[model samples]
Target: MSAKVMPDAKGRQVWIAAISKKSGYSEELVASVLEKHGIRPKVTAAVPQRLMVTSLSFTGKKLGATPPSDIDFGPKPMGPGLWAVTSQRNFRGKTSILNIIRWCLTGRQYIADVMTSWFTAVTLRFTLDDREFEVRLSNASEGTGELLKHARGNEFQLASFSNHVEFEAAMSDFFMEELGLQKIENHIEKDGKGIDQPHGWVWLFTAMWVEPRPSALFGVQMPGAMSARMMQMYLGFPWVNTTNEIKAAQSRFRVKAAQSHLVSSGIRATTEGRIASLAAQRADLQAKFADVSPNTARLKLAEASQRFVNADADLRAFVAKKQVAEDDFESAKMAYAEARRSSQAAKESAAAGYVFRAIRPVCCPSCDEVITEEAAESHLRDHTCVVCKTPDRKGDDEEDTERTLLLAENEAKEQLDAQTTRVRLITSQINEARLARAKASEQCATAEAEIADMTTVEENTVRIQILDAQIAELRNLNQAETEAEDGDSKVLAAAEVITKEMYEVEQGRVLKRVSDLTKEYAVTFGIENLQSVSIDGGVRMKLIKNGQPTFFSKCTDGEKARLKVAATLAMLKVSEDEGVGRHPGLLLIDSPGDNAMVSVDYENLVSGISTLSEELKTVQIILSAVSGPVILSHVPKARRIEAVGDDYLW
Candidate 1:
């Protein structure tokens, strides 16, 4: 049969062969393993002839471009060699399987040559030194029949080539070298010869095909001669080479197994008890359902029979009781209808009587005139003649006349009693006024006595001392002038005298100033006269103006504003005396005329403010005005804050 190998130059298929050994794996198992390794093979034979084949060219198409697929070229006829392609790419390169086989074999070809033999089936051979082993992978092919006969092949059976090869290699390496089983033996000895003996020997083998089929069974042949003796030594006369300790271990294992079986039995019994209890509870529930109600289980036939019995009994009872009640109800309704008609007729007769009597008006007894009942009652109770002041005696039958006479007598007595009360009130007031006058006289006498004890000597003494000093200074200047020789000296003396007189004159002018201030304060505070200024009472000057006594009563709005400004200045003067506006400075008035209308004598008020500002030279005036036409027309440089809304001073 034609086979397909790797892709050709144009990427087309070429003839190739695919061979796969069973290795105790099913066709599906082999297919799965091949697929996992990126090789998809189709199963061509099963049972006696187990093999899988997948063309290299077909696999190449599946893998896409890149590394080319490797094709098998069959083993060498007489030497150890593997057939494989070296050219693993699509482009020009060397293409041969011998090259790949030579790479793997290396110096091991001498051992591998003895293992290369053609057979009908895929038989993989492995040699360890001189020991040769063969594994029949699958049934032989028709073309391989002659070769199989020479090789002494038998009928196909389940076999594992991977297991036989791995086991042979493991045994050879372990016995001949320390890389395998010998290493394990050395480890056991190194632990100590007397250490607990190993219960069993375990061998692990690694073969090329073993990994893909992990679940497949691996048959290991421990040389028959050796295994046979081992079995005899283990079972027959087992105590000959085994220690007593080993026997004890075997006994202990048996006893533990027995105890485990007993525990399992106990668990099973407990489970059975729980099951029995559950079954009993279920039965009780079923019995309870039966006793719940007999009708609960009734069929439709039984329900219909019960319904028919109930309907017949109810119909008969309804007919027997209904007739008697209907007859009695009819007779009672007729009597009620007749009684109701008679009652309605009597009500109509009473209403007719009321309507006829209401048409006429009643007359008033006192006035002897027609009036409504409501008005008549009012007139009778009041007993007054509305036309004149006379008592209305018409309604006074004996009882009412007597009542009226009694009322008249009572009113006369009330008037007499009121006159007596007035007399008593007048007498009481006269007595109270006399007593108040006597108390006032006593208070006046005490006040006059206290006033007589007062004196002004201490105040006059202080004023005399100030006047004496001024007189002595003038005398000294006059004496100095008298010493001069000529009339020019007299003129200079006259000039000095004039200057001294002016100073005295100014001091005297303050009296006029005080008088004017007192008059203004008296009018503004509505007092009779100025009294002494008291230094002890916050610089308060008492006044009695117009028979009204007041203290520091110059409290008009303008005065109050001036007082507030003065107080502010006094506070500032105490803390700092030498700023921009120091003593002996001129007063500047700007907007003083604007608020002049509010002052009593606007011009005099402005003049007084300017004088005070000059006296307290640190002070200044800034006035603003809105109108220039009327009062305060003389004040110049009066700046006005422009008016905005109605009457607003912004």
Candidate 2:
């Protein structure tokens, strides 16, 4: 714990932070531990890094340059806030402008969908930490294959790509250096699967930029719980995400487990029942061997063998008959009991009905309805109970009542009579069953006695030897199963516990920290009732407001827009404070005002974002929005752009 194993984020940091917040430990303790590990980051200068899309130029010719191109979108060098690429509703290539910036920086397929027409090349320039940078990529599908380069200052010198790989490397390296991003393994759950996928430092865009569709949530996949691993790494815990040791252990364990499976399958093919039967046969064979004289070739006389075969056949027939008798007796007993129970139930029901009809009450038993004397007097002709007005099965007339009671009694008596007949028949069958069982048993005993007395001439020495061999083979199989299967089982059990413990530690470090960070940003985004943010259990970006899960898909469009902004910005703020993130303070938010919010809420959200740029000076946010009533007002004259007549972004 003293030696910082990982600098940025660790179980120790979480524990210390927890203790520091409670038991009042000084931050020096945390700083000391952090110094022992991680990149041991140097102090960031007061001046912060900033990214802006300075200019975008497109030529109308393919590959090798031809016609002079027009400047599609260019924003004034507004140092921070946002390099807003606002456009009228027809998309006006506003997204295309943002995407082109994404393409140049990350080499992603920025404009592939919209780049249907010819464009000789697209050049882009931006400044990071006051140092200007440029990327002039050839829209050519051929030649160097990729247009990528790096240059600082006012000069736009050419640094062409040696190949696509080198181009990518250069881009990654430049950003890592500029944005303070470091190389580390980040565990991402691709496609919302629970397993963690470790991607290299280059795959960091999943967090650095915001996807246009905010509902999808976390890091290129559904709120990946492990995505916090990357967020933590960028937040200055670069060393925390490097898990080379566990990976090595996992690799070794897999090989051992596979071999264990092979041995286990072999053991499964043999059954305990077969082994027990073999043991019994082996004992019989041994006894036969003991009786056989080594000098004698055959033990059975031909005449005795014929007699023995006849006795065996008679014994088998007698045993079969005994089994049949026993089965029949059990079936008859069960049937008789069931009939008797049914008859008793019918009798009880008839008795209850008679009691209910014979009695008269002043008030209804149910619902407490009153039975006035006047109502009862009128009830005699209606054949209904005066209290509740339920029609009687028999009229209230003395004769009808008597007849109904008698009918119930007769029905009960008939059921009893039918059951009594069945019971008597079953009793007689039971007696017959016992007699048959006894007779069959006596005959079986006589046949068995005859079979035992009969002698045999057949030799059993070969069979005895075979039984011994089988028993030996089974013993070997049992031994193999014990050795391989048991060992494999133990190893897997231990591995599971170890992996779970490790995951728990990771959960403590990432889950809580991400939530805390996410909540802070959510508050900054004007989310008044933001409760907490959780990225645990593989449920990524779970927003709980007022202690309940806020479903992403179900939220009003406006909420989604605001929340998406909050969650993404939360990460940037985390990286800023933690000083361990590779976020590069770059946010590519397509639009912030497109959700189901009222115009006022949208204005507040836009205003909040505009204010945020000044608060977190190091971060870069590029927004693309349809030129709406609210958008034009907040966006600076220099940053906002409206598409004319037929102008589309693409």
Candidate 3:
């Protein structure tokens, strides 16, 4: 890779800043990708203030069949030093005292159930950076408590809670704010799925205590990168916290990408398979059609289809022509009838005029007398009325009227004849059109029947066409789905790898320092023949014991306990020296000698604790053990909370 692509000093920058610097992506786009994958960068906590226990007290009533039916611990005053809560034997309430104090501080009860059943109330007072505060649990079993602060001579309530959940939240918030601690966010695989689990002040306080059980590494027995996160947090490397956040974000992004890819692959595979099936079906239908029909048969079918279409068009034209001819025939008939009626009326009028002219008066209308022959002959010659002796006035008008009527009748007769001829011609044309339409209709029906004989093969052809369209659509969908990841997934995957590499590189320096100090402290705690100790970036400790490589979990119980104590002290000392770590300068150990086979080894552990406590003046060390000369010789009487013989320390 070129230097431009692989930028130097990548570990010091935020994930987005580092990847986007030379990766040709904008910070906004990178941030959007991170958000899409639910990868949020974490903020490192500020340098913490030292925590010291000044005094603590509690009251308990033992359960049935238990020793010490009732017990009360004092308002014990203490300061920063090695304090021992011990007895001549085990189960002496030494661990109980530590548990009470831890419960008060964190609101999480890790005490044994039988022992917790005996507790009714607890009171603990502590300080952060010399700021005095107190926790008073009036109802310990119910987890109700009040956190109070002291100023001048008065006590002010900081928070009040009524239940365990609220109590834990209150204590966590108070301590986190006062001690300058932030939640340690990480990604873990639970039940085969990656999820976010954040550790608060309670988890951070794990550094202050060590139980009798053997621990593989620092903090609780969390799986994956959590113990490493705890180490980075308490060790307080300058930029290692940012690395931790990047690791978590990268893990989340990978899981998200993997899930998305799986789903997309499944969908694409299904779509492609469907498309292939559709294409094959289409091809099979096409091949069957080609195989079943000869070219001559195909040509015959095509010709029949064309003739059917043409005949159907011709039939429609003939029907329209027949309708026009019928309408013409009816119009001609109507014209002929009107002309005949007019001619008849003209004939009747002409006849009436002629009769009226010919029938002149034979006698006087008033007297009914006959006209004389000479008068009648003279009237006829003169064309006059005989009775009135009036000269004939109806001469030219009567002739003219008769001539006009005759002429009108002749013209009307001609018009009637013409109309009758037109009606005959139109009727003939209508018959001809009807015969042509009938012929075309028969031809269309025959052609249609021929075409219908191939219906099965034509149906297959139509289905094949539909399948082609569907296959094309499916192919488009598959292409779109497959291309979706190239935009975001590609960029995010690159960024994830780069961020992980950055974390690995950045953790090296801090881990080396922790490793060196661990080896030194291990030798001081009497780890025999310790050649070298290596703490990797993942916080996996490797030690060369007796010239053989030994991991933390592979070590003996006694050796693991000593190694854990050594690792804690080493981290505390490193934090103190660095002046930037988050440890609260407190250490608590339970039953340090329980696994010790030799008194010398137990003495060495106690001696190491004493030496470190004296040298680190501001640090507090509290441990519980079975009473022995090894513990009594190093820790003074003033710092010892011991049992009377085999009695309980409570």
The TM-score between candidate 2 and the true structure equals 0.49
CA lDDT, every model vs. true structure:
0.31, 0.55, 0.72
Q: What are the models' TM-scores? A: 0.14, 0.49, 0.64
Report the C-alpha lDDT of model 3 over 1-650, residue by residue, as the tens digit.
Answer: 00112232342245677667645677777767666655544334346567888898888777754465776888788888799988997777888788778888898888876666677788899988778999999988888879999999999999999998999999999877776565767766677577877888888888787866667568778767777777766765444454555566666656765776677677668867876776687666666666455224445645655655665565566566656656665665666566556656765866775566556567777988876788778777886667766665556765676567566656655665665566566556556655655665565566557545543455666776786677677668656655554545565665656654644554576567778888988888888899999988677889998899989988888888888888877777766765657788887888887774478888888998899888777788899988888878999988988896868777
Q: Pick the candidate with the highest TM-score.
A: 3
Q: Which scores greater on lDDT, model 1 or model 3?
A: 3
**Model 2 misplacement above 4 A:** 1-53, 61-78, 114-117, 127-132, 143-203, 215-217, 222-226, 244-528, 531-557, 595-597, 641-646
lDDT by residue (1-650, candidate 2, tens digit) is: 11133333454455345434442335554344333323132222212344665566555533222553344434334455655766666546677677666767765555664453555566666666556666766643321333333544235443466445665666776676666554443233334332333454346676656654554444555232345445444544322333322332333444444555566566545545656676686667666556643431122333334445554555565556556655655565565556556655655765777678657787777777778787877677786766657876633564455555556556655655565565556556555555555565555556556545532223344554576677678778767756644443343333334333434564457557666866776566667687877655343556777777866666665666666677666656654664444455677777666555566776777777777777777766777777776666767776664565566543
Question: Which model, 2 or 3, shows the larger lDDT?
Answer: 3
**How far in Å is the alpha carbon of 602 misplaced in model 2?**
2.2
Over 1-650, each residue of candidate 1 has an lDDT whose tens digit, in order, gives 01122223211110011111213333344334333323221111111110111111100111222563332223322111111111112221111121112111111121123222322233333233223333333322111111111123453322222333343343344322221111111112222232223222222121111111121111122321222222212111111112122222333333443454465566556655655665565555555454333332223334444444444444444444334434444544454455445555555655665564333336544777766565545545665433332344433264454455555555555555554555455455545544554554455555445433331333234444564565556556544543322222222233223322322342233323333444443233222243422211012334454456554335443333332223223322321231211111111122322332354444444444444434443333333233323223333222111223242210
Error of 3 at 137 (Å): 0.6
Who wins the lDDT comparison?
3
**What value does the lDDT take at residue 21 in candidate 3?**
66
